[model samples]
Target: MSKVRAFTILEMLINLTIMSIIMGLIYFAYASFVKQVINYQVSIDEQNELTTSYVQLRTDFFNAERIVKSYKGFKVIPYNNKEIEYKITDKYLIRRQVHMLDTLSINKLTISSDFNIITKEDLITKMIVETTLFDEPIEFVIAKDYAPNLKLKL
Candidate 1:
């Protein structure tokens, strides 16, 4: 006679339990990875916004015909007849035009802001801008490129 052997009920149960534990561990690892990715994306978006705002400001200040301090913020006059203004109100840095009511503003992440202007001469000016984000401070300075008395021209 020949003899045969087969798996017992207890052995099958043990195998299933081991598989379930491995799957649980994999699920935990995946969840943690997803959370970290989300956090990194948020930080990237914030930096992008700050860079955009700073670059736009530099362009405006560099090409401005004149910059003046106003009650709201700054009145930047360009070569054209149109007037563009930057204002700080309601905890936001706002950009708007003189004849229009439409406004564009910094996102809610910005907590504080300041604008300063110095008329170096009739055709030259110096400007400094400071703003706070996520409890961190950032600053920018711009010197107008046009002047006549000192032979510096547009």
Candidate 2:
């Protein structure tokens, strides 16, 4: 009689080993995809926070008459003769101002500046401001300045 054909023990072991390896590879790939997706979501959240901060800062700065000073943790800008001081506290940007209508008492308002960027320019001067989302230090730069109609010398 012809010998019956069947999978030998060695063949079965090899097939099982191959399947385990394939499954491991698939699991690793899926895990990597999940990690990347999480990272992407975090990045998007950070970007949205930054954008919101920037817009609010821009609106406030442009409406003000002038910028008094901007330092690492504090900024003072003038609206008319009165000035608004924005101080960076542990949790929020605290704005202190003497109320225009009532000069005797100081008014305070608090808001978050999770991430912010401010830029200013005129014929004479250019300035930039930036603040990070996660307690990173603020940064400021003076880019360029040209007196009224003076041309920049290469």
| Clash number for each model | 0, 0
Q: Put down candidate 1 lDDT per residue, 8-86, tens digits, no spaces.
A: 8999999999999999999999999999999888878777776777787677777676665666577778878567777
Clashing pairs in 2: none
Off by over 4 Å in 2: 64-87, 90-129, 133-154
Model 1 RMSD to the real structure? 6.5
Taking all chains together, each candidate's TM-score versus the true structure is: 0.64, 0.47
lDDT of 2 by residue, 3-96 (tens): 9999999999999999999999999999999999998888787767656555655555655544434443334343455566655544455455
